[model samples]
Target: MPTPSAEAVLADSAGDAAFATTLAKGLVVLEAFEGAKLLGNMELSVRTGLPRPTVARLTHTLAELGYLTYDPRVAKYAVGARALRMLHPLLAGMPFRQLARPLMQDLAYSVRGTVSIGLLDGSSMVYVETARSGDVGPHTPDIGMPIPVVRTAMGRAAASMLPEAEAARLERQLEAADGAMWSGYRDLYRDGLRQCAERQFCTCFGDYMPAIHAIAAPLFRLRDRCFAINCGIPAFRLQQGQLEHEIGPRVRALAESIRVLVARPESAEPGSRGAKTQTR
Candidate 1:
């Protein structure tokens, strides 16, 4: 799902009599800091659609709480160390990452592409683990990076695992939020999902990024959690045919291996043949 706009987030809480608007606004301020190194009061006000004075108050409170750091000289705010600390538990305890890292590494090495595992988060696929061979190109994203659902191979693969009704709901939501961009690529996105349903994998050729191509497969784990793994290669390095026929199937195999390992970790060690072996 696309990240909710600050207005939308606040609107959701507006109808509730006891909702904490202050806390919500403070969080929206923190979210505005995403992908940004520093934000001044005016920028935060513009992003959050809050008054500059309100933003200043929230920023000051957040700084005091260790969620944000204020640079007095520049009069800007940045994410604080406490926010990084808050993410440690989520990253450190993911069993899926522990089981999938070695397999992702091997796939990256074999295909000479960056490999990643992502989980559906709201309207985006958030990377949980990523691996890359020593290939010199194709910027590998850091963990926690969010990729839009309707524009990327991994996101499509993960979405394919959803029920038809849920998938349709998500598509409608995306179309509503991303109008022209979603309309332009809607056909390709549908085709990729159909391909994923047919072959258990999906391929994208420069759909999200102009010079990037990827093939991905969905993985299902315990408690109905779903994830996806993909191999991303630079367009110059891999042809469309290779992405569809070779890398696509290889990624599917890796995804299935991960599903098995996650389902029964006691039955397969991380680097053991049972976990690493491609089922076909």
Candidate 2:
């Protein structure tokens, strides 16, 4: 079955008269560029399940509003500076990213791996911040990259932080959407969640991608946002059991440190309580 367009889905599900279907459709067109540099109307239509003509009109409106730019040379649209500017506010709202940066960088160097922060994005876990040891590779997560919610250690650890009912609801949604994907990782997902519950961290070995191993722990927050930290090192870099014995505990501690820093009152300014916390 074809995925319905944003307009159709919203129309059916939304009872509120205040809902702006056209505005949503246009935003959906923009979201079609999630992992792409540029896209044409047809591509946007296919990606968003919106009609081509509708996509064309939406793209034109967005371009007019400075949210998108059109390159006549290739006849494609790219997200504009305005759209990038819009993201700045959202990024600014995450007060923890700044506090976690140095700590994550230190941990990445300590383990010869990459340390990243993951936040729930629908059914995916998106990296909102990252620090890494050396040259980047395909497996090294970058900010804005997303991984499966049930398929990576970071995702599993984050999911484990969810309330039981919320987690079960999400599980049902994912299973209903893609039974094959959910089934393939269901048991492993549960195992990872159990590990997080028991040890406050979970490890993924050669999952999410071949030859990539990672450990993650959730950063429990009072606010609604759920975040996790993942430290990923190539499988070859480890001998055996290093993920659990070394990396897991370090990641868990790092997460707790960050949680405290972010949760501190505004009056408790950095370095005011005492010396700055050192990651080393």
Candidate 3:
């Protein structure tokens, strides 16, 4: 099924007395720009399922609040300065990211893959730190990108490390929230979990995209938060059994190394990238 809109995903939340629906609706308008950098009210209304008038009002408020910027010449809106305000503080504060970067970069260079650290967010995994060979350019995933919890080795690996009760609850929630996605990938995802249990890591071949093949392992709970590390390479570059036999173990070892470092966070200069974690 097509990914549900933010409105559809939050439909049940609207009924809560303290939900602040107006605030949520406004954020939904901003979220309509996910893969899209610019959109007008009609497009925003279509993406969000909000009426055009409501979209207009929310967009106006968002623009006023600096969460969005309006382009009169092109008649569109894009994410604005206020969003970066939150990003700056977040990218500057995480101590684990400082601890993880050198290792992630080392793996990225050695494996010629994009290596990323992702943190759980609601039911998804969002990239916290992403290191790529210089040649990969912008074609690969970046920090702040969100991938589904059950559809990725990164997400499933993280889930596998959770307490049994928490893992089962989140699995049920994901299946219910996105049944089509869950139903399609249930078996493959289960295999990933088994891989995690048997070998401390998971492999995903073409699950992310036809071009991307990846393996992942979780850092489990580190300093009260959970994170996963992933190494993804283009399918064209993947040798036979590379993801399963080679990269998978490498990623698991990377996770273990970071887990040890995170267990004992120390005072150190933030790498040039600084705080590379996001709890949200």
lDDT of 1: 0.76
lDDT of 2 by residue, 6-95 (tens): 544565667778888888888788767878999999889888887899889999999998999999999999998898787678788887
Q: Which stretches of candidate 1 lie over 4 Å from their true place?
A: 1-7, 136-138, 221-225, 264-280
Pairs that clash in candidate 3: none
lDDT-superior candidate, 1 or 2: 2
C-alpha lDDT (0 to 100) for residue 71 of candidate 1: 93
lDDT of 3 by residue, 1-280 (tens): 1234456556978567877788878877877787898999999999888899999999998999899999999999999988978876766766788889999999999978799988776567888898988665334888888888777888877666655555666777788768999999988887877777677788888886777888888665544455778888888888999889988888877877886676633223211111222122
Error of 1 at 277 (Å): 18
Writing each residue's lDDT as its tens digit, candidate 1 over 98-140 gives: 8889998888888787999887765678888999988627567
Clashes of 1: 4
What TM-score against the true fold does each predicted structure earn?
Answer: 0.87, 0.86, 0.85
Q: Worst lDDT window (10 residues) for model 1?
A: 271-280
* lDDT to native, each model: 0.76, 0.77, 0.76
Candidate 2 overall lDDT versus native: 0.77
Q: What TM-score would you give candidate 2 relative to the actual structure?
A: 0.86
